[model samples]
Target chain A: MQKDASLTTPAAIRKLVRAGDYSGHTSGFAPGFVQANLVILPKQYAFDFLQFSQANPKSCPIIATSHSPGVTDMPTVGEDIDIRSDLPRYRIFKNGQMVEEVTDISDVWRDDLVTFLIGCSFSFEEALIAAGLEIRNITEHKNVPMYVTNMPCQSAGMFHANMVVSMRPMKPADAIRAIQVCSRFPSVHGAPVHFGDPAAIGIKNINKPEFGDAVTIKNGEVPVFWACGVTPQIAIANAAPDFCITHSPGHMLITDIPNSRMAAL
Target chain B: MQKDASLTTPAAIRKLVRAGDYSGHTSGFAPGFVQANLVILPKQYAFDFLQFSQANPKSCPIIATSHSPGVTDMPTVGEDIDIRSDLPRYRIFKNGQMVEEVTDISDVWRDDLVTFLIGCSFSFEEALIAAGLEIRNITEHKNVPMYVTNMPCQSAGMFHANMVVSMRPMKPADAIRAIQVCSRFPSVHGAPVHFGDPAAIGIKNINKPEFGDAVTIKNGEVPVFWACGVTPQIAIANAAPDFCITHSPGHMLITDIPNSRMAAL
Candidate 1:
């Protein structure tokens, strides 16, 4: 492990992760900074995914995409971001099926590969915590409960999926406050897609989540849901492109931007 | 009605209202402009109300307030907006009870009066309508149904009340689109407070509203409720100051600012 792995700066963490020393979840590593979900695609599908993200911002809010295809460093998000190696792990998909997990993709890096950095929930979760709201998943030390809802993302080109939402159990008042706070950060799955009843969005059971671990639900708390960045992952999986790459779940690219900067206000 | 009653700009409308000529609801008059919910109080109560608004932005979003006590105009929201008579009507409250509904309050105007202009849902409703979402009340030509919710507004000093929400029914898809559209306009009661079950928010009867006329909830439509400007009225009524004035229900003060200007994005 690198000496600076514990440091909260995105550059230091990316350096440690890039050197093949740390390949684990980036959660809790870089507090107060924006952590992004990574998506690498060929230039051919770039416009379609961009259009898809534009149409469905709540699910796939793009913070910064490569200025042009084959560009490894996104000057806007950080100082030194080598998209091929900065993330702890990458999932290589062949026609939508995960084929391999690697720390470095430099060998397969193509001049036509386009990198997209999406806003992650970590930014807004920090905001919610700052506002004194208890995040159930954080308290339980578990991944947020995620469900595959019947709600469909607006189709753009070939990308489409029933939206995947991450759930946080909160009291109604806390949920209202979360809505106000999260609404200010549109890039990070702004506000919530649904709340109160799971069945309303076609989730049959509250105890069983399709992804992530379920946390304890208190007496007064209702499950508040946000459009997850995972929705695009599911869409990409469904589309089954010839070749694609993504950051492994929970392993995000920590960016130099402060979480406060993500706030649209 | 005067020849330019509908044709007049917000400044002209306020000018006419100031001169004690027009004394009707300001709706449908300023087509592309903003309308405000007026609350004028003594300087002593200003900080508390501002705190209350900051704490509960969804219920009482303060667009522009008197820069200093006794300032008659808010240069940010309009030009020459006289705090006393720009509104079509004003309701005088003593100990929280409405004592008079008058066209003008020049007689009661004091040196210490601090005026607050709150964002009204009319601006966002215009945006929603432009986005092709049907506003039930507008279509039925009735006041939007408003209900007192069990949800409490965060208290600041002496200002607090249960939140009041206005309802508009729409199909699930339209409701989703409305959410996205309203999310862009935070100042104007952005997004629905609660949707689906009114009972969730302590609303007992869908048809029986505490304020405004109840519109039909069509077969496939659900009642989407928004945190209303009326919420502050309830708080003000509960707080019951020695002297208070508000715009009469539906008799808003239209501003020269366009509705699009309120979109935070």
Candidate 2:
């Protein structure tokens, strides 16, 4: 879709997505607003997932959850946000496997489903860019490279899996500044987990990522890794839930909350 | 002297230093209080030095300055703080070179002298230790390794010199945590300026530091460097004023201010 001044507001962007007009990745729309990763599961698994999110906040920082099971509206993040159809796209998971990708899940919506709004890297990336640091993946026009690490998340009931992290390369000086800037917004992965060698965290290779395309790591640049929202999706798959839903990779749910409100300081 | 419970207070420690009963380094003394590096100069150079500090804050963070030239007391930082005798030891500089190391500078005191109190690493080191990160220099009983870097500071009038950085080695994860904790105390050199390769910041050998004893950089640990308070001393030496006084290396001015008061948050 062509970028325009009218599409700069979160309300406008979500209106487009809800009307089945813009179903692509919501990467650069509504610049100053927050965009979140979506996760929906049955009521039977809600308590365990909430506990898991609390335990591994860096990876699964929940911005808001459905007021109650069976509620289709998430009033906390945006006005009149329909949990079933507001996001541009979502993946339906059946028995630990993704069965279908669709623009809307209204047809499969169930009364007992619970929705969670998890924090995304886009918020901190905006803060970094505002602080005058270049985000490599954004500059290269690619999704952030992600890898599964040996670090295990605290298990909550049936949920258990190793952490998944997203990588961004920067000079050591820039990395220090990035840490300072990102530290202000703990809800969105906070500071980087590791910055130098990938092998220390169990990643076999820097160039080959398990998800998303690899960006260039310039000379003198170290690969800085942050806990990724994809981590929760891995845990859901490992649990083998009978029914689950998540925003398709890169297609996030735009929220009315301004990103600046997320700064802890 | 033995570190008795009574010496834990800054006032008690300063009383001993003031009486010439203790002329040794002040490390590990008055544990929870703020310690400051002292710089006394003629009124002629005060404005320029203040500008230099504003320009290079990370290196020469000013915690407090004398109310005016010739003022012997600093009511802002401590009670009855006699600028001439409160510090454990003072270094007298003549024509930019060290002339004498003495316990008291009252004999050479002049009405034209101005005193500056710069934040020292001791405050943030306490914070880092409290956060459960091991400081290699403290663990090994050595002064933090300081290096003269090629990075130039923004010059103000006659004051101009390269930045000096203090190094602490830690694993990547610990370095990230250190960055978060140190960012809270900007007055105490704040967060690290660089981490990982020492050569990236112009340090030729990690094992050899220009000032302070070197600590071991264990395997899997990266050396994190913070802007050092010693940077101002280098600037003073380069300026080559007619006369100046500074705290002796590792001997600081214990302040009435609690270290927690320095947190920017």
Name the lDDT value of residue A54 in candidate 1. Answer: 94
Q: Where does model 2 sit among the CAPRI classes?
A: high
Candidate 1 clashes between residue pairs 3 or more apart in a chain or in different chains: none
Q: Estimate each model's TM-score.
A: 0.74, 0.98
- Give lDDT per model, in order: 0.88, 0.94
Clashing pairs in 2: none
The DockQ scores of all candidates, in the order shown, are 0.15, 0.88
User: By lDDT, who's the top model here?
Assistant: 2
User: How much is the lDDT of residue B158 in candidate 1?
Assistant: 89
lDDT of 2 by residue, B1-265 (tens): 8799888889998898899899999898888899999999999999999999999999999999998889999999999889899998899999999999999999999999999999999999999999999999999999899999999999999999899999999999999999989999999999999998888788999888999998998989999999999999999999999999999998999999999999988
lDDT of 2 at B263: 96
Model 1: per-residue Cα lDDT at residue B234: 86
Local lDDT at A106 for model 2:
95
Poorest 10 consecutive residues of model 1 chain B by lDDT? B1-10
